[model samples]
Target: MASGFSLKDQLFNREKTRYLAGLFAASHAGFDPDRFEAEVMAELPALELKQRISLIAEVLSRHLPQDPEGMAAAILNALPPPLDPSLSDDDFGDFIFAPLGELVELRALETAPDLSLDVLAEITKRFSMEWAIRPYLVHWTDKTLARMEVWAEDENYHLRRLVSEGTRPRLPWGQAVPLALSQPLPLLDRLSGDPTRYVTRSVANHLNDISKKDPELVLTRLRQWQAEGVQSQSELDWITTHALRGLVKQGHSGAMEMLGYDPAAPVTAHLQLGPGPVRIGGALEFDCMLQGPSDAPVLVDYRLHFQRPGGKLSAKVFKLKQTRLKGGTARLSKRHPLKAGASTFTLVPGLHRLDLLVNGIERGSLTFDLLAQAE
Candidate 1:
């Protein structure tokens, strides 16, 4: 080992040394590593980016296992703002900064009550809905409820974006916040008539999620919203489709009743089983029909409730559009393939119940057995 290495010499000696120095400078503040590294990695910017990411990952991995909270804070503090602000717009910055920000907020949640709300608000102010809202929604609490309620009224388009995007139940690539599920009517009431198309789309998705769990409530709200006449055409369209998603797909009798349609109209369903079931692989198919009165046009929605390996039933709905019911006959049909995992693995091996919900209420049911077969 060298007897007396200068700070300058130490930094130039190795990649690890450079990384450690950067980490320390960021943690301590006022020591400009960017100014210093301008010369150290001047010739190889790509290498610099890679080394920085690796260094951050290594530090996080080493410390998170022992002190996730402290480690998270350190990581956020250690992130260097991009050397060129333009470079910040790229995915590399997102990869480096997004996780650091999310982890910092999550850890803050663990250490400080309601910290996520403030952190999330700051993040929304800085980034778009596509980036910040998901993390905040997944970890939301009543502690942040008042703040979020206020955000629902924000004039900023992005903050308004947060209102709907954060509360969506089935947001793709996003975690579902169950708490928001119970009291959506108020939030929906606030955003249902928003002028922003971006915000309205999220409202529709949120309503769609609600429809699956409680179609009656969704339909009630839809009726109330329609009666109040406070909604725009876009809002009405969103609410109508989402509130009826579950019922329409399942062809629930009650759902039809709510939609001002008669369920007593003749209807038929057919089930077609695929190749024999395997222990870990197999699929199922369904077909159905709806016969309308001589002069009335009928819309039939259908869905399949699957019973998994553990005695739990999961329902998935599909839309069947509109068809003219010739007084004599109107045909409605559907096909579905079931896969293994959370949705299909909850039903136990014994006899299981498969129900067909027309609008929002069950109209028909069938029993089927799941046997553990050889692979």
Candidate 2:
């Protein structure tokens, strides 16, 4: 990423706030675009990304009619044309319209849930309503799910994606819904065959979240989907790989087998680390050779056991290579970076370890010293 990049600014800024205000102003004669823009801008820069979204929604509540029907009408009318329908994938729509979903949640969740769902269905075409739909799922579980069953078959791909994305067990930055992991499986069953990558990716991610809690549940579902063959063989393969990513990192034998890797295959690994201590802001270079049965596929991954300040080691997994052995042998190498300045995780100078995993089995490991960067 470029230095000084601000995601919040890029997603929600003065221009975006003003654009939303203009849309509403055009829809409602009584709506004042300048006032709405001013109120949202006042706190938008000071707040974080999510807070900015709430700030805009709160401002909308004060400006728009308080009644549920009028509010819903204003929001729906204000929305720009639905995102291009010709595109098959990778269109997430605009971020400015997200507040519209939040506004719907605030104005009509309890008093007029059906109307709220109606508005969200339209608003989602301009932007995903994944976050807004969770409260309904938590409070009106059966009712909301019943509605989702209908949405799963909607003509709009975005609405179809909302069904899967909204129900994710571990949706990032999303509100937690208390539904049982299995409860949403039925909905996923319907969405698993969606032709759009946008929808299928969400289905895969939702299953990946479930795999964290119930590996067998996800494995079983994948098996059933494969047997049923609702989706093409290639597309289902993509979904299976994406959904089982977490389990693969954990060296789950069942997940490995499901992906057609033999966890118990006879394999031997030899690891060699580059000379000299690795410093922060430098790279940790290493190479390895694997000896396995000819024509057998191998899923190779390297785990780095990072040393923390208090002598505890935090392990992180990274993909190395995925290929079939040639002449019963394969060679792989990597140059992992050690950045001194990182936003999330800090690097500590100390002894660290790297372990090689092939087909969900640890084959070899070695230790190396990490040094502080030069001042």
Candidate 3:
């Protein structure tokens, strides 16, 4: 991202707002595009991204008919068209259409719950309703999930994705639903064999969220899926790897074994660190060599223990390489940059430690000093 990049401004600007207003204007002649655009633009610049979405939806609700049926009809009519059907993945549709989902959540959830689901089904075809659907899942859990069961088989991939994404335990910027962790498993089982990567990715992510709380449950479900032979081997492999990423980072033996890596493999290793102390803005280079049984697979990782305030240290894992030993030997090197100007974590100048992990086991460790950048 370039400097001074404002995501809220980029997504909900005057042009996009006008475009939405025009769509509604074309559908409802009585709809005032000017007022809709003006109200949205007024508070938009001051609000955050999600707040801007609420502002647009609020403004739109005032312009539409107060009656539920008429409001839903106008929104359905104003839609430009469902997003292009040909693309398999990465077509998230326009963010401008997201507010319409909020409109559905607001107007129809109470007076017309089933009708709200219907509108959401259509609006999701234009833009995903994952965020909007959470409230329904909470207040009308069984009914919404029953409807999602049918959607799991829908022809539209976006709707199919919502069956998983909407119910995810850890959806980004989404409200939580009061349901058991395994409640959505049946839906995931149905979607596990989805042909589209867009749907499968959501299934994988949903499983990943489940894994955080119950690793064994996720692993068991994966085993069941594997036995069913529903999804292709290659795709299943991708899903398994992605879903267990958190466990693998934590050196969970079950996760490593499932991915065909022997966490306890007998391997000898040595690490060589470039001369320190490394500056805050400089790179920390290192070389590592491993010796093991012939052709044994290795999942190599490194951990950097950083010095934090209050004389404590925090460790972060990083991937190094994934390869098999060639002639009983494997060598890897990396030039990891200790970047400055990071907004999340500040680099402190002090003693730091680096540890090498082979097949999830720490093989070698070393310590070095990090210097603050010169003014």
Residue 89 accuracy (lDDT) in model 1? 21
Per-residue lDDT of model 2, residues 1-375, tens digit only: 999999999999988888888888999989999988888887788899989989999999999999999999989889899998888788998998888888888889989999999999998898999998999998888889999999999999999999999999999989899989999999999998989999999999999999999999999999999999999999999999999999999999999999999999999999999877799989999999999899889999999999988999999999999999888999999999998889888999999999999998999999998989978
Residue-level error in angstroms, candidate 2, position 52 = 0.8
Give all candidates' CA lDDT scores: 0.54, 0.93, 0.93
Give model 1's clash tally.
24
lDDT of 3 at 145: 96
Q: Which residue runs of candidate 2 sit more than 4 Å off their true CA positions?
A: none
Ranking by lDDT: 2, 3, 1
lDDT of 2 at 41: 83
Backbone clashes in each candidate structure, one number apiece?
Answer: 24, 0, 0
Per-residue lDDT tens digits for candidate 3, residues 1-375, read 898998888999999999999999999979999988988888888899999899999999999999899999999899887888898998888999999989988888888999899999999998899999999999999999999999999999999999999999999999999989999999999999988999999999998899899999999999999999999999999999999888888888899999999988889998998766688999999998899999999999999999999889999999999999989999899999998979899999999999998878899999998889967
Residue 288's C-alpha lDDT in candidate 2?
96
TM-score for predicted model 2 compared with the true structure: 0.98
What value does the lDDT take at residue 215 in candidate 3? 96
- Rank candidates, TM-score, best first: 2, 3, 1
